[model samples]
Target: MFDWRWDFVAEIMPRLLWATGNTLMAAGIGYVIALVLGLFLALGQRGSNRVLTTILREGIEFIRSTPLILQIFFVFYVGPQFGLVLSPWVAGMIAIGLHYSCYLSEVYRGGIESVPRGQWEAATALNMTRWQTYKQVIIPQSLPFALAGMGNYLVGIFKDTPMLSVIGVYELVHTANAIGSENYRFLEPYTLVGFIFLAISLPTAALVRLFEGRVRSKMGMN
Candidate 1:
């Protein structure tokens, strides 16, 4: 039918963009949490006590082995049963951050270990404390190795933001669904949603590739 209202597209566009903004904010916050928490997980898994490291390793394994969707559900629904009520958006962000933190910890650990043993020796020879060694010597050198993985996960988080719609987060996909339900026209809304997702993800992937090239070049690995 040629009865589709063109003006409706104009009206929905603003709301869709607004929802997209929310999704972006959620992703940004979630990634920050993942970055900080991932560092802690990496540190915890590596430093000092054998029992602590074992627990941290097992926790990482458990999180990595489970489905993120189930984890989201558990954080959102199960927590409420215990008198800790987190909003869907909050729970979704927390779940995503926690899930990705485990993965990022491995990336960090690999990056750190990949650094030359001589570098560690040099830091020790300089009488640098552990904190100073990591702060000044290790982290700076290991960043390029970790950067590619971090960028990959940032794009990954953007892609996964759509899944937050299931928890009433009102992301792009959620906006599209609402539009479709109201208009009984699935084609336009769904197509637009797909296009928006592609617009975001494709550029992010391209940027990641660019970053990877730079990192490789800097390391002379290219």
Candidate 2:
């Protein structure tokens, strides 16, 4: 009852590969957004404005507590009611980016807190601006601590991109589902998707670990 067809695999390969590119684009754009926004969120929490910090903390908590699929659906579906409709790609990216940004903010907070208080004192002693303190000293030191979490979310966003399919973004899982529906061969298409994900994720995780070590060594934290 097990029949594997190489021809079917070959036929669908091109479409899947094309979709893979879209998936990577989605993940890359979302990750960039999350990375920058998460940093701002983390800094906001530590900033002088108590009200803003409280709001940002609550926002992050709310996002972290919800399911990402619900977020994606809300952005894509509910926005039209408020006159802020976005395309599938834009909506998916924003939803994924915002969802992951909350998690990454926590990672950044931990990293920032790990910096010794003496470092802040030293920055003050050296007449460094707040910007200079974070840019030159705190951030560089926190990077190694943050890198592992950042990398995990990089992969997490990639995995979660499939949820975008519900909104009609033509990413890998969507393509595979299309192929399966057309041919009624879920086996090959789904298995191939798994292989493709594994192919990407394994190498990325290894590189993250490698980069973490290099960063720590350079920062003399090794």
Candidate 3:
């Protein structure tokens, strides 16, 4: 029987906890970038110019079509070849933000489209400019729809943070790998890593569900 090393676990616990802070920071920054950039992409898609709309649509489609891992590799490695020298954290956040922005842009598009056409017509009849109409009428009503989708991506980002380890971001999973390698005790480190993920994700998932319910209720959909 393989004996458990309690001493090793105790020693690694602090390191794992410390690394989790980095993970959370990365996730937080990545989410912020995704949110801001996503709104822009969505607005671009819905802009007045046909060329901008086409470009936005194609750009989003290309991002959604590609695997995120390759995107990370490309941004971290290939980008430097072209004179873009991004740190691992910056590259990871940018990659994640860009990839997820494509998805959230679709969410924003759906939200904007879901607003009643009559609202637009009413604003136009009132001599409201297009920007004014969108700002004062369309966006407020569509916010709830966007919120639900945004919440989903927040959860998605949390789950995908492990991928950042590949770029040398030193998140929780990366720390776990280091501990396991040093001690050659794969079982404890991997198992603890899974538990850590579950502890963080399950609660976050519940919050998303609660927020989704609130949004639906507020939108009169529930």
Q: Which stretches of candidate 2 lie over 4 Å from their true place?
A: none
> RMSD per prediction, one decimal?
2.0, 1.1, 1.7
Task: Give candidate 1 misplaced runs (Cα > 4 Å).
Answer: 1-7, 215-222
Worst 10 residues of 3 by lDDT: 1-10
How good is model 2 by TM-score? 0.97
lDDT score, candidate 1, position 209: 85
Instruction: TM-score for candidate 3, please give it.
Output: 0.93
**Shift of residue 107 alpha carbon in model 3, Å:** 0.8
- Collision pairs in model 2: none
Residue 64 of model 3, lDDT score? 97
Candidate 1 clashing pairs, residues 3+ apart or interchain: none
| Backbone clashes counted, model 1 | 0
Specify the poorest-scoring 10-residue window by lDDT in model 2: 1-10
Q: Candidates ranked by TM-score, best first?
A: 2, 3, 1
**TM-score versus the correct structure, for each prediction:** 0.92, 0.97, 0.93
Best by lDDT: 2
Candidate 3, residues 81-163, lDDT tens digits: the string is 99989999989998998999888888888999999899999999999998899899998888887887888888888888899
